[model samples]
Target: MTAIELRNVSRWYGNVVAVNDVTMTIGPGVTGLLGPNGAGKSTILHMIAGFLQPSRGELVVGSRPSWQNPAIYRRLGLVPERDSVYAFLTGEQFVLATAKLHELADPGAAALRAIAMTDMADAAGRRVATYSKGMRQRIKVAAALVHDPEIILLDEPFNGMDPRQRIHMMELLGKLGAEGRVILFSSHVLEEVERLSGTIQVMVAGRLAASGDFRAIRRLMTSRPHVFLIRSSDDRRLAAALIGRPEVAAVELGPAGLQVRTSDFGAFCAQIAVLARDSGIRLRELLPTDESLESVFGYLIAN
Candidate 1:
């Protein structure tokens, strides 16, 4: 299986650091790079793809150092977030050009195969400039796969895709991962990452905050209280009932409803409905305030 490794790596431009002493291993399967905007996901991917040089430490793809190694391109395929396709070229021509650049034995056949794989065969004759955002994304994937690289790096691959298009691409990535290819894609959307990848690497302000299965990572943060916003028919009575529960850490009465902090997420969720019913309180709304990735990252950073 192909793998990429980074050891105590750091990258900076002038005085600003983009990646800070990150050491992680990316192996065969789909791994999600999860982080907020400007969180160094792209920077890390660029360095791994040999597009940028690390200021310190080492980065390797298989047995070779990625920096200054043009041969890595033979096994590594990067689909950058930027829109860099040639507007004048048709989708087929674009993939064909990439195949030729990779020195494939038969560029025509490879391009055709890639276009078909990405479900872009129908639009292969259309000029790239005329394609929709999602179509442009598919064409980029077709170009990336033309050479059939073992390691695929995608930076926000679902940026412009609608629900249907996104689901299709997700299935495609899952299939690629199942075929024993190392596929890593960066995304800020938690739902996308949760649905696609089994493992995740989270970056926060250039630092690696968490890594591994998200559920496991969440379990590690047991001390980090889960906050909830709850509105009920009788806010005062519900708040009183919730405060008496052993699972609840604290409860505050608010203008909107009851703001609750729970030490045990699972327990709180499981007992909320029962507690409301027993207290004769009708549930109007219940929202987890700290369920977002940003909130989770903040909790991690604070620790």
Candidate 2:
């Protein structure tokens, strides 16, 4: 199986450190590289794609260093965040050029196949300059996929896509991952990462904050309180009951709803319904406000 590995990888620019001693193994399947802006996600993707070399430690793709290794491109496909397509060339022409560069036997057929995969076949004949931002993103994905590589690296792949385009791209990536092709994409959008990837590598201030299952990581953060927003028939009564529970650390009644902070998430979840039932309060909405990627990232960064 194709895999990317990093061992104490560090990339620095004079006084600035971009990727700071981060190490993780990205195996076959969909993996999300998640972080806020300026969190070194793009830098790591660029280094893995062989656009930049690590300043220290080791970075490898398929057991070989990607830096100064032209052969790595054979098994790797990259859809970069930046707009790198030539506006003058038609979408089909651009993809065909990429296929030719890869020295494919039938570049035209490969380009056509990739264009169809990206749902860009209808607009493939039009010049890239006439396409919308989302269309351009699709064209770029087509060019990247022209060679049918084993490992695909995408940086902010859903940047300009509309809801329909985004859903299609997500489905396409999921399908590719299911076929056992290593797929890694970077995104700051918590919902997108959570919805698409089972595994995520989180970056915070150039360091690897967390890795593996996001939900598992959240569970491991026992020190941080789990917050919830609850709306019921009797908010005041529910709050009064919740404040008396040993599992609940704090409770606040606000205009939105009752915000409950619980040290024991599982315990609180188990008791909330029972407490409501006993208090004769009808439960309306029970949302775990901090059970999201954003909250996890925030906790990691803060710590």
Which candidate number would show the highest TM-score if scored against the true structure? 2
Q: What is the lDDT of residue 290 in candidate 2?
A: 85
Per-model C-alpha RMSD: 3.9, 2.5
Q: What tens-digit string does per-residue lDDT give for candidate 2 at 70-175?
A: 9999889999999999999999999999999999999999999999999999999999999999999999999999999999999999999999999999999999
Each candidate structure's TM-score, on Cα atoms with residue i matched to residue i, is 0.80, 0.88
Worst 10 residues of 1 by lDDT: 292-301
lDDT of 1 by residue, 1-303 (tens): 449999999999999999999999999999999877887999999999998999998999998899999999998898989998999999999999999999999999999999999999999999999999999999999899999999999999998998998999999999999999999999877777877875889888898889987766775798778889999999999988988999999999989888999989899999999999988889999998876555665666676
> lDDT for model 1, on a 0 to 1 scale?
0.90
Query: Which candidate comes out best when scored by lDDT?
Result: 2
Q: Give the count of colliding residue pairs in each prediction.
A: 0, 0
Q: What is the C-alpha lDDT of each candidate?
A: 0.90, 0.94
Clashing pairs in 1: none
lDDT value, residue 123 of candidate 2: 98
Off by over 4 Å in 1: 226-298, 301-303
